[model samples]
Target chain A: MSMDFGGLRAVDRLDLMIHRGEIVALIGPNGAGKTTFFNCITGLYTPTEGDIHIHPPGGGSKRINGLKPNRVTELGLARTFQNIRLFQQMTVLENVMIGRHCRLRSGIAGAVFRPPHTVSEERQAAMDSYRILEKIGLESFVNDLAKNLPYGAQRRLEIARALATEPFLLLLDEPAAGMNPHETHELDQLILRLRETENVSILLIEHDMKLVMSLSDRIYVMDYGRKIAEGAPGRIKNDPVVIKAYLGEEYVA
Target chain B: MTPLIEIRKSVLVSIWFMFLTFPIMVIRVNTVENVVEWRWHNMIAIGAGSFLLSFVWRYMIRRKEQGIRRQREGAGPRLSIFQRIGQERRIFLPALTLLAVAVVVFPFLVSMYQVNIMTTAFMYIMLGLGLNIVVGVAGLLDLGYVAFYAVGAYTYALLNHHFGLNFWVCLPIGAALGAGFGILLGFPVLRLRGDYLAIVTLGFGEIIRLVLENWNEFSFGPSGISNIPRPGLFGVAFSLEAHARYIYFIVVALAVFTIFMVNRLQNSRIGRAWLALREDEIACQAMGVDKTRTKLTAFALGATWAGLAGVIFAAKTTFINPASFTIWESINILCIVVLGGMGSITGVVLGALVLVLLPEYLRAFAEYRILTFGVVLVLMMVFRPGGIVSNVRRTYQFEGPDSGDK
Candidate 1:
C-alpha cells in the first residue's frame, strides 16, 4: 500500500502478508510510517494505491479499499490505537460491550422496548464481554470508569475491548507503549495464549525491541517509508540493512 | 493549611459570589411602572451574607478535603452517600416504589393550580429526557430541539382545527410527524459536530418557527389554532379541577413511560452505541457503529418523546401559537437536561421540577424569574457542572462473580 500526504509519501509501496495464527510485528523508528500503513489497512485513511485484501477464515477474499472504518471492523478485523483511545467516561464493561457492536443485531425497537429476544441477546453479550474481561484479568475493574484505570490495566482493557469483537485478525498499534517490564511480560504471555487458544492472527506495531523480538513470529522492518528487511527473528536481527537503519551498529558487533 | 491562604480563597469566592448576585439580588425592576429601583438595603444584606457564607463554606471544604486525603492514605475506600445509594441493590427497589406511589398521590393532594404547574413540569421533564438523548447520550449538541416540539404541536393543532380530529387521533400523528422531522432535520447536519451542529439545529428551530408564523395557511400564522381540543377520559367531560387532574395523570403517565424507555435504552446495546459515539466518534466508528444510523436514531428517539410531550402540552393548554415554540423554549428544555445531570433520567426529572416550579413558588419575584434562572444556571456551571443529579456509574446484575443472573 502506498499513502501520500500532498508531496510527502507517508507509506510508500509497503507490502505485508500475515497468515492465519501468525504473530507479525511491524517495527520502524518514529515517523517511518508504521502507523500510517496500519491506518491504510483499517480504512482510517484511504491508500492512494494498492488494495487491502482480507481473507475471512470462512473463505473468500475481498479487496477492502475505500471502505469506512466501521466496515473494516465488521469484516473480522479489529485494532487498538497507538495512544489508547478508550471511552474514558464509560465503565470498563461498557467499553468491552461496545466491542460487540458489529456482532449484535439489536435496533431501536430492540433497545427501547426490549423484547425477550433482545434482552437475552443483551444478557449474552454482557456475559461474553465479562468473560473477555476476566480473560484479560480486568473483571475487578468492570464497574470502574475506563479513565480511572491504571496505565497498564487501561492498555489491557483496550486489548480486551478489541478481543471482544472476536476478530480473526487483530491489529495492535503500540500496545506496550507505556507498560512496565512486568506488564510487558504479562502481555507477551497473553498474546501468545490468545494465538494458541483462539487461533487469532496478530499484527502489532511496537518500539520495545525486547518485547518485539520475544513475541513476534516474524519481523518486518521499515524505514524512510519503505520496507528495509523482512525475515525470521535470527535472520532479521543480523541483517545489515536493519542494523544500519534501526538496530544500530553496536547490536551487529 | 495557613489561615492566610484560607482567607484568600474565601475572599475570592466572596468576590465571585458578589458579582454573580449583584444584578439579580441588588436591582429590582418595577415592570408595572417601568422603573428600575436600586435596593441598597437588600444589596448590603446579600453582599455581607454571601461573604460570610463563602468564608464558612471554604473552611469546611478545606477541612473535608484534608480529612479525605488522610483517610485515603490509611483505608481501602470509602463510599459517599451517592455511591452508597447507587450500589446498594436492596434499598433501590423500595425507594423507587415509594417514589412511584408518591407521584401517583401528588396530584390528589395538591391544589388545582399546583396540579397544573406539576403537569407543566412533567412536560419539561419529557422534553429534557428527549434532549438528553441527543446531547448527553449521543453527544450531539442540538439547540433546535423545540423544532420537533413545534412540529408535534402544529401537527396536533392543524389536524384538530382543520379536520375536526380528536386528541387521540392527533397524538399518534403528532409523534410520527415529530420523528419524521427529526430525521429530516438530522440528515443535513449529520456530519456537523459540536458548535456547528448546535448552530444548524438552532437555525432549524428558527426556520420551523418562522414557517409556522409566516405561512398563514396551515398553522393559522402567529395567531395559532385556538381550541385545539383537550383530551377526554372515555367520553366524560371533565370539570376545571377534574381537567387539571386529568391532564396531570396523562402527563405523569407519559413521563413515566418516557423514563422507562430512556432507562431501558441507557442499559441496552443501542444506548451503549450512542454513548460510545458521543465519547469518541472515531472509536465508535472503528467499533463498527454506523455513524449515520446511530445519529439518526438518537435524533428520532429524542424527538419522539418531545412530540408526545408537545401533544400533551397542546391538549392541556387548549391553545397553540408560534410564540410558544421559541428558541427560548429549546434553551429552557436544554437547561433542564444540563441542570439535571446530562445522561441521567432522575436528574432530568429533578431538574425539570426545580426549574419549572421554583419560578411559580417565587411568584413575588416573578419579574426577576429569567434573571434568577441565569444566575442559578451560572452557579450550577461553576459549582456542580455535572448537574443536580449527575449520572452515577452503573453495574449490571450479571457483573459480579456471584451474580444471580449467571
Candidate 2:
C-alpha cells in the first residue's frame, strides 16, 4: 500500500506483500519515507490513500489502515521505535514484559489479589519475557535498568520488547540504527534467527545495505515516499532507479 | 535447574515469606506510649529475619538469571510465578489490594486520632497516586497538581456555601471543574516537556493560588471558607452520637476506590499507552498513541483524583482553606511519588504514609521536625533515588496460543 501526502507523496503507490516468516527490508536515502511507510503500515499515520492489510496466523485479515498503534498491536502487529522507546527507569526485563501487557487479562482486582490464576499468568509472562530476553542475548541484563544497558543491548532490548507483544508481523524501525559493525552483524543474525526460528514475519527499515541485503528475503526501495524499485537483493542492487534514488547513479555504475 | 537457580528461588521464596510474616510478628510487640521500644533480643530477632529475607531475595534473583541463561542455551525451564506476573502490574495490584483491605477495616480497629490521621494520609495518597499517573506513568512532570485540588475544594466551597448545595452534589461539580482546569493547563503546556513542562505546571499552580488569594468575593481571600458540611451516608450524618468512625471509614473507602480505579487505568490499554508515551512521545505518536488524548487523559485523571480529594478534605474538616491546598502540599505529594518510586503504587502509598506520619510522630521535636523532615527526604533521595521500591519493572509474555512454537 502506498500513501500520497499533499503534493509531496511521502509513500508513493508501493505494492508489497510480506508472507509469514519472510524478512522484508525497505531501504532508501534520507526522506525516502521508509519510516513513514512503516508508520503507515503499523497505524501511526493514516495514509492519504492506501489499504494496509495484516493477516494474523488465524484465517483473518485485519484492514489496519486507520487503527491506532495499540489497536494494531492488539491485532498481532508490533513494532520497535526508530529510537529505542523503552521505559528507561524500568529494568530490561520490565521493558520486555510491558510488551506482553496486551496478552494479560487480569484487571485491577486480579493484579492486587494475586489469585491463583493471576500468579500463574504472571509466572508465564515473566518466563516469556526472560525467553525473549534470552533470544535477544539480553538475559544477562534483565535486572539492569533499561537506560544502563549498552547502546547495542538497548537496541536488542527494544526488539525483545517488540517480540514480547507476540506479533505475527514485527516492524522494526532501524534495528541497527546506532550499532557498530560487530553489533550490526549480530543484529543481522538475530533478525534471520527471529524469522526462521520464531516464524515472525519482519518488515525492517535499515540504513545498513550490507545487513539488509544479507538478511532480507526481498527488498523494496523507496525515495520521496514513492517506491522506486522492488525485486530480489541482487536485482534491486543493480536496478537503475534504485541506484539513482538510494545508492546514487554515479556510485552504482 | 542449576544449583544457582535452586538457591536463588529458595532465597526469593524465603525473603517473600519473611516480608509476609514481619508485620504479623510486629503486631505482637506492644507499643509504649507513642514509641515502640525494641529490646536487644527483639533487635536480634529482627536482624536475623532481615538477613534471611535478603538471602532469599538474592537467591531468587540469581535463580531467575540462571533460568534466563538456560533458556539462551536452548534448555529453557518452565514458567515461574515471577515470569508470569512480569513487572509492571506486579506491585500495583498487591499494593492496592492491601491498601483497600486496610482502608475497609481501619475504622473498626483504629483509634479516633489514628482514624483522623489515616483520613488525611488517604487524601495525600490519592493526590500522590494521581500525580503518579501524570509524572510517573506518563513521564510528565506536573508540579501544579495541587492547583487542581485547590480548584476542586474551592469549587465545592463556593457552590455549597452560596447555593446551599450539599457536599455530595458539589463533589462531581468540583471534579468537573478540576478536569476543566486540567485540560486548560494541558493545552499550552503539553507541547513542553521535562524541566520546561515542570516550570509551566509550577507557574500554573502558583497562578491558581494567586487567583484564589486575590479573588476576595469568590474565595473569601485569606479568611478561607468554613463551616462546610460533612458527608453523610444516605441521609445519616456521621456524628458522635452515632459513630464518627463511619466518616473515617467513608474517607478510607474513597481512598481505596480511588486506588482501585487508578490501578485499573494503569493496567488497561491507557496505562501502556501512558508508559509508551512516557518512554518516547514521538515514538508513541508514531505508534498511533494519540498524544493529545493520552495527555488530556493524564491531566483529567490526575485532576479528577485531586478534585475528589478536595471534596473529601472539605467534608472531613468541615472547613476549606487556601492554606490546606498549597504548592508545598503539591511538593509533598510529588515527594511521595518520587520517594515511593514513580509508577509504583506500593511505593507511593509507602511514601505517603511515611512522610505524613513521620512529622506527626516527631511533633515532640517541634522546631527540629521540619529540619528533620527535610534531612530525611534528602537522605532518602541520596540513598534510593528510584524510591523505596525502585526495582519493580513492567514485564511482558509472548507465549500465546498463536506463538510460532515448534
TM-score on alpha carbons, each prediction: 0.89, 0.63
Which whole-number lDDT from 0 to 100 does residue A144 have in model 2?
Answer: 72
Candidate 2 wrongly placed segments (more than 4 Å): A1-21, A48-63, A105-124, A127-144, A148-153, A177-190, A196-199, A224-226, A240-253, B1-122, B151-225, B230-276, B282-301, B321-332, B335-406
* DockQ of each model vs. true complex: 0.57, 0.12
Error of 1 at A108 (Å): 2.7
TM-score (0 to 1) of chain B for each candidate: 0.86, 0.73
lDDT score of model 2? 0.78
For residues A36-135, write the lDDT of model 1, one tens digit per residue: 9988888889999998899999999999989998888999888999988899988888899899988999887887777899878877888888889899
Best by DockQ: 1
For each candidate in the order shown, give its overall lDDT on alpha carbons: 0.86, 0.78
Candidate 1's TM-score reads 0.89
**lDDT computed for candidate 1:** 0.86
iRMS, all models: 2.0, 6.3
